[model samples]
Target: MIERFYLKEFLTFKEADLEFHPGLVVFTGPSGSGKSILMRSILASVGLDSVEAQICESSVTWMIDEERYGLQNESLNTFRHVKKEKTRYFINNQSTSKSSMESISSTYLRHLSLKDYSDFDPSAILKIIDERISARSPQYAGILENHRVKFAEFKILSDQLRSIEEKEKHLSELKEFALYEIGKIDAIKPTVGEDEELNLIKKQLSKKEKIETVIAQAQGIFSFESHVSSALGMLEVDSAFFDDAMNELHSIIESSLERMEELEEVSVESVLDRIEQISELKRRYGSVEEALEYRKQKALELESYETMEHSKSDLIKQISAIKAILETSAKELSLKRHAILGETLEKLNGYLGMLYLREATLNLEPCELNASGEDKAVLGLAGTKLDKLSSGEFNRLRLALLALGVESMNGGGGVLMLDEIDANLSGEESMSVAKVLRHLSSRYQIFVISHQPQLTSMGQQHFLIYKDDESRVRELDDAERIDEIARIISGDSVSEEARGFARDLFERARGL
Candidate 1:
């Protein structure tokens, strides 16, 4: 239940704050007095869409233990358009997200009316019955959760299987392409340093003849004896005076002669053999670096292909196992749904009678199991389907569903918001709806927007929404509420007959 609501800079409402209490609370006013606008603001602050107006600031406070009926924690604020495009949400003064606020708020507050009756949807019908029937059983919640999990898993696997099957026709071709590319890289047999080695060999081969010629010229220069012969001839002629110099010069020439002979013995065959080896390497490997890279790639491909078959087999097995589990879970869920059909039908029948339909029947039919469950609800009046019923009849059927929801809720009931739901109802029918709402209020916090005297009179806390000068405001006061109801009855002229009717309705409702 919303303990309080604060609005600022909202449509037709510059600033307004209202406190809500348990039991029926009514908002009454003349048409176009900003009643619906105020309601819309409250809904927007709680994460619902606004009517072409952004919520500048809004806050809602709820009771803590009130979570069982759907209120989990207390106090939520939504601040928007403060300084940027982002909107800020808070729960208990702690900053949160809009999604979180929406999820938590939905637990405690359920906005329902003739325009939106999701509780009456066929998919929700079974869950409602189960919540009531299994209220005392701890195992019931666990069972339902288990069923939900199993159903979710089943859906995921089914989707995956379908996707895989769709792609299966191309699997063989894809595998073949992968294999061919992997094989081509594997046969290259490259090595890391092979490119550098091959390049060095190629260079040597290109300069081989030049290198050999240079070596031969240096050997020939050293082998020549003419310079030594000339130096010996000069020493012999000056032997007496230059004996020491001549002997030293002769020793040097003899040592030079010995080195020249040794150099001439060096083999050219060894150099040619080294060049040939390098040429052979370059031809075979293309380049040493490329060879090494090729080897690494080939190794990786071999490892991948070695395990491909096993991995594919495992995936297939997993898909099959999940399918089996899903089938079993879906079967169990279907059975539970079938079992609850009778109770669901009986409750709808009761509400129909209260709704002024003397001969109404709710029929249950089996449907294929989906995520929400399998039983479908079909309403009939004197054996005719509800779609064939008039608009008024449709609204009444919706009322019946609301009544059923009220009966089924556990512990502290949910907060219900009704927006002119009794608009087309007759005086007696309006009274009946009001009575049901009043009874529901014992376990819930209810806020109603109504023009009907029956509903307005039954409000335990009545708030009148009206325009003052140029602004709209809501105030809680008995005199104001009476005047508002009187206006609704007489249409801007509070005649004696309208006042009397309002007084009588209030008296009768107070007795309830």
Candidate 2:
């Protein structure tokens, strides 16, 4: 339960702090005296408004005792700060996010008001009834979980099949494109390493003449050495002294003559063969590496097209199987849900007093199955639907649903906050609303914002919101509450009769 709320610079409430107790806590005030402003401030602090206005500076603290509900070692305080654009929420002094705070608080604070009649929502109604019925059957959650997974899988497969079916007409065109590409590369008959071999052969042919010229120059030097031999013979006249030198000179000339003859016999056939090989490579492939890459691409395309039909058939089969499974699961779920609808209607009718002429029913009509079940709620009163009910009747019906929910709750109930729930209600209807709210307070921490005396008197903790002379809104207590309630009864004039009426109402509420 929310233990205390503080507001600062929020609308007319410059600064105010109020404490709340268990049971019914009602906020009553004159018109335009910041009653609604206070309520909005509280909602804003909890991150429920879209005003984009900063908190100015405020703190709200909720003291939770989970042990009362059989939870272990879980006593903590939750708080919210409205200082900057982003509201900071904290639990047990640890920084947290608004969503986290709201989630945790919701379990402890179940706010039901006349504005939100649970019976009107089929999902919430189903959940409550299912919980009661499933309490004896622990396998219900597992069953629901399994069905949910199956439904999701079926949806995914069906969507994929639809996509493939839509594109099937173009599959033939795609196959034709792939075949054309593969055939174009296959006809080339390219080979790897052909480019490098061609490059080597081309270099040899281009430098062929230069290599031959160098060989010829070496031959001429050896062939013209006859003049040197003649000069060596003349130098042999110094017979005995020149004998060793002349012999060495003759041996060198003979060896040079033999090497010249061998050089002159060099062949051009190897160069001619290399030139022909390079020319052939250029004519066939343009470039050997490019042709090899083309061959690889063609092979991949052929493989892809060959397997496409098989893949399409497999996807179709999978989609059909998933659809069958989903249909079976959904049928089982619908059967179970329909079986329990009758008991749910009985409980709703029992709580909402038959005098209201209301008949709530659930219709499991055929609908396109989705994540939620294919069922709808239709609430009628005397053959008139709930949407057509008068505002007063709607409020009463909502109150009845709340009373029923509280009674059905397993442990102490959630905190219930109501804003102007008593509006447009008749005196007798107001009395009935008060009685129900009073009974609900025993199970839930009920916070009500009402203008009716019946509700105001029902409050276990009465707080009056009013403006001081400075026009700043503040919460009043003790004598201030009595004076404010008296003012509510007397309007601008607080006569003895009005004071007496306010006092009598207070006394009777205390006794109750």
Candidate 3:
């Protein structure tokens, strides 16, 4: 509930500070007395309406989710909209965005001044209908739960089936791509380290001739081996060490010749070409190991592509089975919903009867399966759609629809701000509307504007707005309320009979 409201430097009213209580709060005055302006300013303070007030603030009892919104929740949370060159929103003096403020406040406030269609949503309607059905048949809850479980299963299977179909649509291209990638890698059957070996051979061949010439010239030294050994003996050096050294030199020369002979079998062109192929592979795939790994992966993909039809056929069978079960459950639900639709309409019509409006109608039609069910409930008036009704008639119908949910609510529902709900209504019609709102006030903090004496007199708290140099508002006491209601009944020149009538009506409404 809004505990206090303050508005300053607005369209007509300069400054107004008001405290409020829970129940029906009715604002009434002559035309152009800033009644609507005051209401809009209140809504703007909560970020629900756009107004040009310098400072519009509301102190409410709504406990904001402090952790979620990252703001402190005072016992009385203050929502303020300050309009300077631009608009700014704040909660508890902490700066917040307009959207954030609106999000937090909308949970506790519902402005039904427009043709809101939320009441007629199929999910919301179906929920209420199912609740009623469950109350009558306890077994219906399990049945509904079972249907919901199957519906969830059905959705998963249907999505898999759709995915399979999409894949099948491009199956040929996918198969071709897998085959192309595999074949491209297969054409280069290069081995790891083979490139390094070929490059080594190429390096040997690059210097093979120079090394051969050098070795050919160095072989002449073998002829002097014996001469050097004899000289070493004559010089009294050890002949054994000299003979071992010559033998080792001869073995090195022979080994070199043998390795040179082995090079005869190696074709430089084949070695270079192999080197080029391996280089290309390395450039394309980073390494021979990575290329081989890619081939293995594509082989598996190709295998799956070859057997895709089997997978698709199996998925189709599963979907068909699940869908058949869902359809059965849907039909059962449809039957039960049809049974409860009349009860729903009768209750709505009962409320409408009191509001002096035409009866409302509800119809259920078959639709595709969803989480909610397969029912599309349509709510309309007897001869017209809800949108085609006049503002007064539409608003009253909205009230009746809201009344249906009031019974299910456990505690304080929320605040409801409405425009002139009793406008263009007969005295009896006005009183009927007032009575319904008075009942609703028990559940919600209702704020409304009125011009008729019947509705004004029914307010739990009445405030009279009048032009005294500037538009001003004051809460009316018993005598003051009587005079205001009288003015509404008989205009500026209030008759004694109007005063008496207003007093009696106010007392009777309160059961005094």
Candidate 4:
């Protein structure tokens, strides 16, 4: 609930500061007196709307969850909005994004106007039903949560089954493709580094003829070695050394000649063809090693495809088991909701009757299980859909829903702002709406703009928005309230009868 709110330098209103209370806080003034603008300014401070203003601030108090909002151990938070060229929002005097401010504000503030569809959202309707159900039995809370969990699991499994079933329709074709890929690579019979080895062999074969010619010339040098040794013997000095040197030369030349013989056996064409084969494999699969790896991968894929039927059978069994659990949980949830749903409808209709709507048939019907639950709620008023009702009926209906949820709301409740909620309503209808709001005030901090004297007179805190030369807001004293209520009753000119009536209304409200 907002403890206080202030607007400064906004349109029509130069400055206004108002303290709020727990009950219905009504802002009453003539039309075009900047009441809506003031409410908008307050909304802007909470990041709910945009306003051209110098400053807007609101002080709120609620139980703080440190884990959720990243807030410290404090219950009171101050939100401020400053609009210049760009609007800036802050929480607790720390600079923050507007979205963050809005998120935190949403917990304790529900600014429901007449046209809000949030109360009719599927999730919200389900929440109301669940809240009322839980109020009746705590066990249903765990049951509902478990059912929701199972529903999520079922959805995931269903999606997975659909995907696998679709893929399995082409299982035979996929398996055959995997086999064909493996076969293409297996026929190559690639080995790691085979291309490099073949290239080296090809280089050696290319140099084979030149190597043989060099070997023949080297053997001729060995042939001259005998003559050199004979000449050395005539000198009679180091002929043994010359023979040793000649033996070394002969060994080196014989090794070279043997290598040439080895090259003669190697076919250059065969080496080239082998290199080309390895090169082709490299081009296709990146490398000889990678080609072998691909073959292994495809073999594994083919194995998985071969075993797909067994895997699918296992999955089907798991899905069937979970489906049983889902069916039981959904049915149990549906039963519990149906059991409490009648009570909820009765309470809603009770509120509707209080709000002066007599002929409304509201019911919750079981539907196929989805995320929310196995039921859908429908509201019909006098044989027409609730949405097709007049703005007056719709707003009153929304108020009725709010009154039903007040005791069941989980948190410390929220601030509810109603703009001209009693404008088109009859006097009795306006009083009924005010009474309902007064009841809701036990749980929600209500801010209502009204031209109705009954609603204005019922305010726990009443402020008057007026435009003299400029717009201004002031809390109405007891006597001041009489004048204001009288003004609202008679409009622009307060007569003696209007004053008497306004006094009686205030006196009657106080007596209540």
In each prediction, how many residue pairs overlap at the backbone (N, C-alpha, C within less than 3 A)? 13, 0, 0, 0
lDDT of each residue in 1-512, candidate 1, tens digit only: 66677776655767777777789989877777788887777776666544444443444444433343233453443333221355565555556566655665677787774345464566666666667656655576666677677668767756766655654566666557656654554444334554455455455555656755665565554444556556767776533444565556557656655544544554446445644554454565555455445545755655655665565566678757855665666566557655766776776777777767756565557667565445565555675565576666666666566667667666776677878868888988887788778877888888888888888989999888777654466665666666667777888879988888887777777787
Q: Taking the tens digit of each residue's C-alpha lDDT, what string does model 4 give over 404-428?
A: 8886866557788888888888899
Better of 3 and 4 by lDDT: 3
Which regions of candidate 1 deviate over 4 angstroms?
A: 9-12, 51-56, 61-120, 136-140, 153-168, 189-340, 357-364, 367-395, 411-415, 439-444, 478-487, 490-501
| TM-score of each prediction | 0.64, 0.60, 0.73, 0.75
Which 10 successive residues of model 3 have the least lDDT summed?
Answer: 401-410
Worst 10 residues of 2 by lDDT: 67-76
Per-residue accuracy of model 2 over 342-450 as CA lDDT, tens digit each? 8766876765663243666556566776654555545555566777777667767776666766655666675777778778766555656777889888888887888
Off by over 4 Å in 2: 50-125, 177-336, 354-357, 370-374, 381-417, 438-446, 471-487, 490-512
Whichever of 2 and 4 has more TM-score, that candidate is 4
| Segments of candidate 4 deviating more than 4 angstroms | 62-74, 121-123, 176-304, 371-373, 492-496
- Candidate 1 or 2, higher lDDT? 1
- Clashing pairs in model 2, backbone N/Cα/C closer than 3 A: none
Q: How far is candidate 3 from the true structure (C-alpha RMSD, Å)?
A: 7.4
**Candidate 1 Cα lDDT to native:** 0.65
CA lDDT of each prediction against the hidden true structure = 0.65, 0.64, 0.87, 0.82
Residue 273 of candidate 3: its Cα lDDT? 82
> Best candidate, lDDT-wise?
3
